[model samples]
Target: MFPYRPMRGLDEGLYCVDGSFGRSPLGRRMTVLVLPSGRLAVHSAIRMEQADMAALDRLGPVGAIIVPNTLHKADAPWYAGRYPDATVLAPRKAVARLARRMRIDGTLEDDWPAELAAALDRLALGGVRMPEAAFCHRATRTLILTDLVFNLGVQFAGLSRLLLKLDDAYGRFGPTRLFRWVVLRNKAALLASLRELEQWDYDRIVMSHGDIVETGGKQLMRGAFASLGL
Candidate 1:
């Protein structure tokens, strides 16, 4: 396993959860996101240890587990069970497919769903895979994301990490052109997700990777996506 050092991220009112990333059983890692309410969201949840669970409990109990997009299975049941009360919520369209592969049945909720309704502003980033949504919670001006975009660090392994410096994104936060160019399938949907993300009101961006964007984040994200012609 890689050293589990996490981002000691933004101290803003929004409790940004830190998820360590390494290789996944599926060949890519799945980063976990912890919500202020103590909820957990990740790609797959199998065998997530109790120590991590206890650490997250400090932020809040896992009210819900979000499987951001359909591609990853990190938020699986084995992981969800770590929190006795948390239920897994996935996108409406991906529910059945996820259920079949994981043997874990989850309830699909729209956008931030009803539970998160009070806290998030739902903007439709249509055409990108699912009806991608970018959210803004007024309490913290924090925007939560789902593959809608990426910003990797300069410290990761392989030649890809070195090239990341081209974006002027050195070992901290900001967009990773390499990661984006490789992962984004259907540029049309990616573009839509970007356009919608720009309209959101937020100063902090809580990503599933790298460092969190702290200030002028909205502008940073705008420039990040706009460069792709999204």
Candidate 2:
């Protein structure tokens, strides 16, 4: 079995899977941010469910659950109504895309405080305008991302296995150069964003469809951007 450690402030803790192909979805460790009051801000919600509500009950309640992005929107809503005061946080653009495919009533973009923006700027993890996106658990040095970069295959199934063979996301780790050129809209700004994010010194990463990088997360991001000629 892979190794896992309970991150004190983060309940339900973090786990990691290691293998030749790197960690797959099944072994990704999500960092759970449990506030003193008992509210929790879980990174990705695959393992979360209605039945698990009782365990989370110890905390006052669940507040502001985040889907992080459209790529990982599938499992978020199952538990939304369970919490009296929680709404899924999704990129404004993704809200429509995901809603069309699922029954989700998520919140639009949130206005972050200037202090938060400045802090990110100081760390070089400045703002990114990727249709609809947000930074999470600033204190954790964590960045929640969607399709801007896919660390794993999309629709990993029978036919998809073959189709993904040539698709940029398959067998590929991190963002492909062509995908970035085609989807980034403006390369100059994206490069600037990467540079800013590099300054933040983040050590962990949470992606919608792949594994969680416990350490060396910043290097993975830096390496991916470097491949794009940034």
Q: Return the top candidate by lDDT.
A: 1
Return the clash pairs for model 2, or none.
Answer: 123-199, 123-200, 124-196, 124-197, 125-196, 125-197
**Residue-wise lDDT of candidate 2 within 1-230, one digit each (tens)?**
23333332321322221212133432343434554344555544544433344554554455555555554544466656565466455555566776775544444335332333432212112234345353544556666554556577354766656555555666555764445555567666677767666666567776544555557877777777785455
Those runs of model 2 whose alpha carbons end farther than 4 Å from true positions after fitting are: 1-31, 47-50, 58-60, 95-109, 112-139, 153-161, 170-172, 176-178, 227-229
* Candidate 1 C-alpha lDDT tens digits along 80-157: 556556666666666777777554445444435455565556554544444334557656777766554455554555
TM-score of every candidate relative to the true structure: 0.67, 0.63
RMSD of each: 4.9, 6.8
Weakest ten-residue segment in model 2 by summed lDDT: 13-22
| Model 1 local distance difference test score | 0.54
- For candidate 1, give the lDDT of residue 198: 70
Candidate 1's TM-score: 0.67
